[model samples]
Target: MKPEDIQIGKLVRKTETSSPLVECFDMKTNTCPIYMCCGLKGALSQAVGAFYGALDRYTLEDVITSENRAMLQHILLRSKLQPAAGDQDEVPDLMQGVP
Candidate 1:
C-alpha cells in the first residue's frame, strides 16, 4: 500500500533532532493477549529500525511526501524479503502461491 493510504499518528516522543527518533502508536486497539509474543511485534520492530536508520542517514524536510514515503515503503518491503534470524536456508519463498 502507498504511504498516503496509511495514517500516521501524533509524535509520541523525539529522542534527538540530528538522529531523531519518533514513536507513533497505532490508534486501533487490539485486545489480544498473545500480542506480546506474536510475529507482528517482531516485524514492526524491524520496520521501525529500518525507518529510523534511514532518517539517521538522510535529512528529510517532509517525511510524508510521496518520495520520502516511497523510500520508507521500499525499506519495509526489503525487510520482509530478508530471511529471519538464523533461518537463512529455511526461509520460504514468499512469492510462491499458497496451496
Candidate 2:
C-alpha cells in the first residue's frame, strides 16, 4: 500500500516501502507530520528517534517510571501527617552551603 493511503499513527513493518520515511512533530501546529516515500526503514528510524528523545527528556519525577510513581505517592501520603506549628522557612538558604 502507498504511504499516502496509510493513516497517521499507523505503524507498519519496515520492508513494505519503496523509500525511507522521516517522523517529525510540528509543535507549533500541535501535530505529528510524517514525511513518507523515503521507505519504511528511515521512517521507522525517525519514529524511534522521536520516541527515545521524549523518553530521555522525561524525568523520573514526571512519574514516567514505577519508582517515580511510588515516590510521589509516598510524598503525598507523608504530607498529610501534620502541619508545622511555627513559622516555617520560606526558602532554602542554598547560598550558605558549598555547591
Candidate 3:
C-alpha cells in the first residue's frame, strides 16, 4: 500500500501496538494504590491522547520523503544483496552492547 494513504494511528492500532512506557496508564493492568488521585495518571492520559493526535496528523508519506526515499531504497537494496556477517539466528555486532 502507498505510504500516503496510511493512517499511522490506525495502522498502529490494527497491529495492536503497545505504548507501555508508563505502566500505570493501562487500566486493566494498573495496580497503583493511589488510582483515585494520581497526578501522573492524569498527565499520562493527556500524553497518550496527544500521542495519538500527532499520529493521526501524518501518514507514512510524511516520514519517508522523496529525497530520503532514494537513500532508503538504496540502503534496503544493499542490505538484501549483502551476506550477513554472522549466523542468521544470531544478533548483529552493532547490538552487542545491548543486554
Clashing pairs in 3: none
Best by lDDT: 3
TM-score order, best first, reads 3, 1, 2
Query: Which residue pairs come into collision in candidate 2?
Result: 19-38, 19-39, 20-38, 20-39, 21-43
Q: What is the TM-score of candidate 2?
A: 0.28
Model 1 lDDT vs. the true structure? 0.41
Off by over 4 Å in 2: 1-38, 64-99
Model 3: CA > 4 A from native: 70-99
Worst 10 residues of 1 by lDDT: 6-15
Model 1 CA deviation exceeding 4 Å by range:
1-30, 60-99
User: In terms of TM-score, which candidate is strongest?
Assistant: 3
After superposition of all CA atoms, the RMSD between model 1 and the true structure is 15.9
Q: Candidate 1 on 1-99: residue-level lDDT in tens? A: 322222222111131222222222232445566665666666677887776665554322234455565575566457654444454344333223211
Q: What are the root-mean-square deviations of the candidates from the true structure over C-alphas?
A: 15.9, 20.1, 10.9
Q: Write the per-residue lDDT of candidate 2 for residues 1-99, one digit (tens) a residue.
A: 322232222222121233224323323343343333335555667776686566555432332255454564556455532223342423222112111
Lowest summed lDDT window (length 10), candidate 2: 90-99
